[model samples]
Target: MAVIRVIYKEYIPSENLNSIVDTIWIATNYGKEIESRILPDGYVDIVFDLDKQKHLNSGNEIRISGMMTKFKKVISRKNSETLGIRFKTGQFNAISNIPLSKIKNTTINASDLFFKLNNSFLDELVEKKHHWEKVQIINKFLLAEINWSDLTPNKLEHSVCQSIQLNYRELDLNKIAKNHYISLRQLERRFKATIGVTMKEYHSIIRFNKVKDCIAKNPNLSLLNTAFDNGYFDHAHLSKEIKKMSGVNPSEL
Candidate 1:
């Protein structure tokens, strides 16, 4: 029998960045090499790696993983620690000036943007003995470096993002536009500019992510039931969408 590889993940809480950051997770993969599929959840992240041979040849420990449209396959080496910050949708812009669209599908060096920290920050973060200590360092760094100007919103963009996130699968774009009192075209443009994906795309991701979570957590969940609960037309429809988004069958996932 093959030994199952375990990837340990610990989520650290942060009251300071609660509004902008969704999760601060520290993970380490143990045992043999493993290929883990990362499903998109409509969020961007900043990852700091203690080991970086697979990330880039440039030897940069920090990189930003942008909003993803599809599942990303990541091969993890044994015994490597990774610390990451998952940002809430539309919140990245509140801290950085870079257009979300530019990095939509790629991971880039954090240095490309103007965000900065103490030179010893990464070293201090890695040397921490406990998970919460690292989270504290990160939270303080972000709170000190957060560019307040980016959080300002001019119109309904903030509310719109929240509305879609709250009602992703069942939301009617028409109704949202009406409630926001913006033309459909204007809504599309704003979503593209702020979210890097159109409103429809974001909603689709949310729906798929929900199902992915369900399937992973609920062993007794039937495919047909999962489809019905998530608003898919049927199992066939769910399977097709899953294939398009994750390039794998529902069973494989």
Candidate 2:
């Protein structure tokens, strides 16, 4: 069986998060046994099944095998096959850069979106050539067809979230604001308004995500080394932030 591959991690900027939602991808070549217990955080997901059964906790454990697609708001599960994107809070704002207040909570058929992409889009991916080009094609197609205007708040939030995700680790907001010729306060306010979270909270999420990547890359890495490598002040501070966000000690994970 092929080992699960974590392609990449991104931090969505406040502007993009307001306009576009964040995405997570786990790809496998030969298929592998993958499971994880995800915590609740108010984001929704639309999952696409490849070959394995995708399960979720919604009353009874919902198992989807074969080619399938579905959507859900929240799930409470200790463990299950992990295949999907975890939309963060305020991430829905980017689903189509529309106002959140105007968007009535509704169900969207996942197959409608997935199938719209040419069968070649999926077929070509199986060969792993020019994958990014194909993804751009899919994204453009979806953006053009989705009703983005109806969710203004989410759209704006999505934009900001995507921007943060893209540049957070390398660029600080203060520098970003100075480069953009805006005051730090102005940037913060704009981010908060669009993303429904403070700049600090967003940064914390980015940092935590970075830590996860570091650990995955080097399982034997020391916590202090990992913390310093990722720009944290020290191990204690990193541990505190991780606990606050994930409700688990770093050592335990």
Q: Could you tell me every candidate's TM-score relative to the true structure?
A: 0.86, 0.47
* Per-residue accuracy of model 2 over 134-248 as CA lDDT, tens digit each: 3444355446555655644444445555666776555477666776577888877776655445666666666677786787788898889988888788889888877765567
Model 1 C-alpha lDDT per residue in residues 195-216, reported as the tens digit of each score: 7788888888888888888899
Q: Pick the candidate with the highest TM-score.
A: 1
Which stretch of 10 consecutive residues in model 1 shows the poorest summed lDDT? 50-59
**Error in Å for residue 163 of model 2:** 6.5
* Residue runs of model 1 more than 4 Å from their true location after superposition: 1-7, 52-60, 115-120, 153-155, 216-222
lDDT of 2: 0.49
Clashing residue pairs in all predictions, respectively, total: 0, 50
